[model samples]
Target: MVGLRVLTCGFAAAALSVAGCSATGTTGTTPSGRQATTSNPAPGSPSTASPADLARKQASAAYVGMWRDVAEAAKTSDWRSPILSRHATGDALSVISRSMYADHRNGLVAKGAPKTYPKAISADPSAGPTTVMISDCGDSTNWLKYRKDTGELADDTPGGRRAITAEVKKAAGGWKVARFAVEAVGSC
Candidate 1:
């Protein structure tokens, strides 16, 4: 009975694996005759990503780039850095500028860059998206504020992962972050 149960369980697991593969429309043959899986498209089908998918990718990239640019500018508290404008605009740009300006006023500078993992939550007009909403968990443990003159930590608090949401728009120059709100640390 034990041996029979083991065999039945193995068959059931194999059946589930096959079912999952079929559900995803993925099928290929490995050199060893085992099944290989690919994304979305079956063999010989067009693998081009849809317009909405492309927009999502572009918007996510822009959102992440904005964080990077802001971090770079924070290193010296350069609120006027042109790099900030490259990936951000409107409310997003204004927020970054204000934060950097405040940091400058406090004689503070950031020493490291925050890590961002941005995902596209939604895209308008599924066919050719003009706007995308992004959700992110931004980790800033390595990024910390420090005093510019003494090179010492600014406060007793430490940075942590936070939840972030943003809106990105398709502009003539490509995708740009229009607005973003970051929640408190540990919110992620």
Candidate 2:
């Protein structure tokens, strides 16, 4: 069912670093707060965003961007692809790499055109690298599965909504996904 697809997307999301993102969709909110996805003040324009607000937004975008990229990588099984490696680490990486291998072996892959509307973005400033929680209206309406290398497309499926939590930490480089999880939700 759609619910399982949503969960699978989440699993891949953690693995590939993104599972939902649609540029055409409207805005959304989450329990943590909506500031994460709020419209950004134009660069160089005088703004009222506190330092914390700006940090939250940047972190949120990075986290959400991971899902978007992961979803797009459905057709590919190279879990170590540059994009996925940049966002995922630890168990998340293991899961995604293993799953992709399985998909390749079974000749199956998913195409979940995830359109994520991040409803909430919250971060703990005191935490190192900052811990962030992103709840989004995960709308994967064009979601589908396919027979890999065969181009056999399946039915159109939709992932209603999903709550994703990721613990992001600052490494020698930029932010990295230490751990993350996805859960199905009845509403955004």
Candidate 3:
């Protein structure tokens, strides 16, 4: 009888210790006290990211790429630069811009169109892949050079600088330009 009591106490103590470890989420004995959870990860323990998340990321990337293109076009004074016309489709489509506007003031200069130092800067945020908008200031006005000079040239300085705003949309195959606008900002 005494030997049996000693054996029972030893087994109970060991079981209690394992229970404590399990409560702390450590690898420890199972309730039956025959097995313990292990540190080794189960098969496919790490789940894959969802498709929606991937699409959103792609959209963000496309938008950034398009913005870079627009900035590059501005620096180079080229309205026809390819960067301004990127498009994407599906989830990626949301990332590309559909419409964009350029200040035609400088484009006019490139085309040898005559104009005052400061010109009426305009935007074209409405042009999509299937639709294109042309300058409306009549044939006498130049459409080549987007109005890069602000109205600041008046007192021997340039006029207000202009900025372009774009609207983007996803398309069937890729992305499309949806809208464009030009805003005049401060005197140059």
The model with the greater TM-score, 2 or 3, is 2
- Highest TM-score against the true fold, candidate: 1
- For every model shown, what is its TM-score relative to the native structure? 0.75, 0.63, 0.31
lDDT comparing candidate 2 with the true structure: 0.54
Please report, as a residue range, the 10-residue window in candidate 2 with the lowest summed lDDT: 13-22
Best by lDDT: 1
Ranking by TM-score: 1, 2, 3
lDDT of 2 by residue, 1-188 (tens): 21123333333222212122222223667787764455654432226444444445555666666666566565565555667767666665566666666666767767656666653245555333255455555665566667777768644444555555565555556655556656654544
TM-score of 3: 0.31
Model 3 lDDT per residue over 66-130, tens place: 43454444443454555555742322222222122223332212222212121111212323222
Where model 1 places Cα greater than 4 Å from the true spot, the runs are 1-47
Off by over 4 Å in 3: 1-47, 87-169, 172-188
lDDT for each of the candidates? 0.72, 0.54, 0.29
Instruction: List pairs with backbone clashes in candidate 2.
Output: 17-66, 17-67, 18-66, 18-67, 19-67, 21-114, 29-119, 30-119, 30-120
What lDDT score goes with residue 115 in model 2? Answer: 68
Task: Please provide, for model 1 over 94-119, each residue's C-alpha lDDT reduced to its tens digit, 9 standing for 90 to 100.
Answer: 87787788888989888877888877
